[model samples]
Target: MMASAGDMDTGSVLLAEKVTALSDPAAYPEFTAAVTAVETHFSWVFLTDGFAYKLKKPLRTEDMDFTSLAGRTRNCEREVYLNRRLAPDVYLGVVDLMATEDGRLRLFGSGRVVDRLVRMRRLAEDDCLEIRLKRGLVASEDVARLARGLAGFLTSQPPLGPVSPVGLRHEINTSLLDLAVACDGCFEQAVRRVTARLLAFLEYRSDMPGRDRLVDGHGDLRPEHVFLGPPLRIIDCLEFSDALRRRDPVDELAALGMECERLGGAWIGPVLLEAYGKAAGVFPPAGLCAFYRGLRALVRARIAVRHLMEEPIRAPERWPRQAAEYLRLADRAAAELTVPSGRRPSSSAAL
Candidate 1:
C-alpha cells in the first residue's frame, strides 16, 4: 500500500535524502539505467530517459542566494519564464520533490513538499553548438539560423532603457580586481591595459552604436547554451538578475562570438554579426563591436580565473590555463579598439 499525503512527516526531509532519491532511476515514473547526474556550481541536474530535473543547491553567494525554499522556487519559476523567450518548448515547468508517509521521496506526488525541481525536456548533447563546433560539424547556415533566431527574439523584446557605462565599468573593475588576486597578479599588466582601453571607449565613444538601444537579452549567451536547429533554441539565461539581463543586443552577441571563438570557431563571430546586422537592420560599427568583444573577453577571463577560488576546485589546473587563454584573446580584441578618426557616420541609428 502507498502512503498518503496526510500521513507524511511535517518536517522537511534532508537534502541528501532528496538527492539520493532523485538519483535513483526508480524515483522517476519511467525508470531507466541511463540516468546520469551532473553537478554544476549552483545546481544538480539529473538527466533521466527523456527528461532533466534541476535541483538548486541551498547555498548563498555574493551575487545570488538560494538559501531558502521560497528563493529557490522563485528562481526556478523565473528561469522557466525567461528561458521560454528563446526555448519555449524546452522549459517545461517547476515540480516538487515530496516526502511520503512511508519515509520515501517522490516527484509530483501527493505529499509534503521537501524541495523544488525544474523539469525540462532533455535535449540531444550532439545538437549543442559547443559540441558541434568541436566536432567540426558547424556550418555557415547553422550560424545564420542562430543569428536570425536570436535577432528575432531580441528585436521582439521591449527596450529596457539605456545601460550605464559607469555601472558597466564598476562591474568589470570588480571582476578584474578579483582576477588579479586569483591569478597572483600574473596578468596584472594585461588587466590594466584592458581596463584602460575599456574605460576610454566608455568615456569618449558617445558616438558608438547601440548606446541607447538596451534590451532584456540572454545574459549568458555562450555556445554551450545554444542548440543548432532549423529554429535555433537558446537556453540557460541569467534569470537571477533582471538588471543584468538588461543589455545591448550587440554586447550579448559579442559575448557569444567571444565564447565561440574560444572554442575554435573564430569565423562564427563575423558571420553571426553580419547576419544579425542584416536581420536587425542596424550594422554595429566595427570599433563598437571590437570594444564589446574585448570587454566580454576580459570579463570571461575573470570568470575563468575565479573558478580557482571555489572550495575543492573542479579541475584545479584547467582554470589558470583557460584564464590565460582568455586574457590573450582579450588583449588581441582590445588591440582592435582604436578610437575612430574623422570618418563619415553611418545611416543606421542604433544596434
Candidate 2:
C-alpha cells in the first residue's frame, strides 16, 4: 500500500529524531565526550572519541539509491565488505538504529529497526595523506611506501574485463554537458578541445593501452581517503556501482597522481610512478599516463562545478575556484598528449 502524505510526514519526523539522537553523545553504547556530525554528499557521519558511524540519507541520485530501508541496509553491508579490502581493521560492522516502544529512537535499541549505520574505527586526522601533504609533512619515502602498497594490491586483483573507448567517450560527453550547465558554458570549448585531443590520442594508438587490465579497484583514490602509516590504510571505495569501480590500474594511479599534484605535491606524482613501476614490473607509457590524468582532471572539474547544482550549496565560494584549478591541470596534462615520442613532461611544470 502506498503511504499517505501524513504517514510520510511521520516517517520524516522519525528520521529526524533518529538523526538528532545519533548526534547526541548519550546515544552511544559507551561514554562519549562529544559527538561531531559531519555531513557529506550522501551520508551523515557521527564522529565520537574512537569511532565514526555513517548513516545514509534516504535519498536517490543518478548513480545511487538509498531511498528505501532495504536499499540502505544493502549499501551499508556493501560499504563494510568492500572497505574491508583495504582497511579491514577500520570497518567494524553495521548496526541498526531502532525505535523504542515509548516512541524514542536509539542506536541498537531493542525495537523496530528504523535505520542502519556503518560503524568504523576512526582514523587519526593528522595521519591522512591529504593533511600531511598540506602541512608539508609528506616525504618521498612516504610516497614510495604508498606506491609499493598500492601496486601490490592493484596487481593482485583479477581483471573484470576490458575498457570500452566508446563507453568512455560517452561518459566524457555527458560530463561535458554537465560542466557546461554548471559553469555557465565558460569551459565548454576548452574542455571539448581537451577531450577531443584525448580521443585523438586513443585513435592514434589503434589499440587502447591497458584496456584489458581493468579490475574492481578502489574507485575514489584521493589523498584524503589514504592514511599514511607503516601499514597504510585506504578507505571509502565507491560502494555503489561495480561498473564504476572497475578500472585500469594505471587509470587509478593517474587519478591519484592528479590529486597529489592538485594538493601541491608534484614531486609525489613522479615518485609514485617510479615506485609503482618497479613493484608492478612494467612501466606505464608516459603518454597514456598523461592522457588518463587529463581525463580524470576534466571529470574532477565537472564534479567540483556540479556542487553548485546541489540545494543549499556547500562551500558556495569554493567550487568555482576548485573547478578552475582542475581545468588548469587538465589543460596542462592534455598538452602532454602532443609531446613527440611519448616523452614525459617535466613534473615541475607550474600549475
Candidate 3:
C-alpha cells in the first residue's frame, strides 16, 4: 500500500539526546578545534574546523527508515556512496559512534558500536549558491558555469534503461489531493482548477515515458545543495529510496529550475535548460518540463502545509504564505504546459 502524505509528519527520536551529547566538542579530541552543531529535520551535523559529522535521528517515515541502529548505519553507508557521485571529496565516508571502556563515546573506535555518522569535508556558507542568490551575488556567468557543469554531470551518468513505468505519477496524484486539503480554502477556485487540471493531465498520461533515459541522480536538487565554487559540490541527496534516486535527467533539471524560480533567480532556469540542451543534444518536451515544474511546486506546497498539520502547536509564521505561493506556482506551471512550449513566455508574474 502507498504511504499517505501524512507519513511525512516530523517526529523526534530518543537518540537525538545522545546525538546532542556527542555534539559537544569536549566529548571528542578530534573536534577540539571547532564547536558548532546544525540540526535539520532528521539529523544533527557537528561542524569542526575542517570537516563535519552527521548523525541521523532514529525515526521511520514513509520514504525512509532510520529507526534501527543497523538501518542508520546502512543509510549512512548509502549516503556516502550515493553523494560521492556529485561531491566526491566532500563526502569522505561513514564512521561509527562507539561507546568506549571508559564509558565515553568516540567516533571511529572499536568499542560497542551504538550509532554511525556520515563524515564530510565542510564548505563555507558564502560558497552556497542559495545564499549567493539571496545576496544578489550570483552573476549570469556563475550560473552559466553551473549550468555547464551540471549538464556535464548529468550526461556523464549511465542511463538506467527502460524499466517498468514508475509510481511517480501516483505519487503526484496523492500530492495534489494533499495540497487541496492543506490549502484550507486559500485561493479556493484556482487551487481546485489547478488540482483538477493537473490530475487529469497526469492521469491521461499516467505512464511516464523515456524510462530508458533514467539515470542514477541526485533526487533532491534544491539550490541550497548547490555550492557555487571553482570546485562545484552538490550534496544532501534523498538517500533512502532507490526508486526516488532513479530518475529522468529532465525531471531532475526541472526540479532545480522550479526551485531557482522560487528563490527569485527565475532567469537561472532558462539558462540552465539552454546549457543542458547544448550538452545533451536533446531535451524533454517543454510541456513536459512545465508539468514537472508544476508538480514540484505543488509538492513543496504540500510539504510546507504539512508543517502546520504536524507541528506540536503554532507552526512557522511563513508556512501559510509559503504554501500559498507554491500553489500559485503550480497553477502557473499547469497553465504553461497547455501552451506550445517551443519557446518560454515572459509574463510570469501575470501567472
Clashes of 1: 0
Error of 2 at 133 (Å): 0.2
Candidate 1 positional error at 50, Å? 0.8
lDDT of 2 by residue, 170-261 (tens): 66666677776666788877777776667667656544555568898999999999998756999999999988888888889999999999
**For model 2, what is the error of residue 302's alpha carbon versus the real structure, in angstroms, after optimal superposition?**
1.1
Candidate with the larger lDDT of 1 and 3: 1
* Model 1 misplaced regions, further than 4 Å: 1-12, 209-211, 340-351
lDDT of 1 by residue, 1-351 (tens): 011122123264555676788888877766668678888867899999889999987766656677677878999999999999899999999998877778788884687787788999989888899999999999998998898998898899888776676667776677578676776788888887776666666656765534457898999999999998645788999998888788888889998999999999999999999999999898878777788888888887887887786666889999889888888888888788764564322322111
Best by lDDT: 2
Q: Least accurate stretch of 10 residues (summed lDDT) in model 1?
A: 1-10
Error of 1 at 138 (Å): 0.9
What is candidate 1's CA lDDT for residue 204? 62
Instruction: Output the TM-score of candidate 3.
Output: 0.85
- Provide the clashing-pair count of each candidate structure: 0, 0, 0
Ranking by lDDT: 2, 1, 3
Give the Cα-based TM-score of candidate 2 against the true structure: 0.91
Model 3 stretches astray by more than 4 angstroms: 1-13, 31-34, 108-110, 161-166, 200-208, 311-315, 339-351
Q: What TM-score does candidate 1 get on C-alpha atoms?
A: 0.90
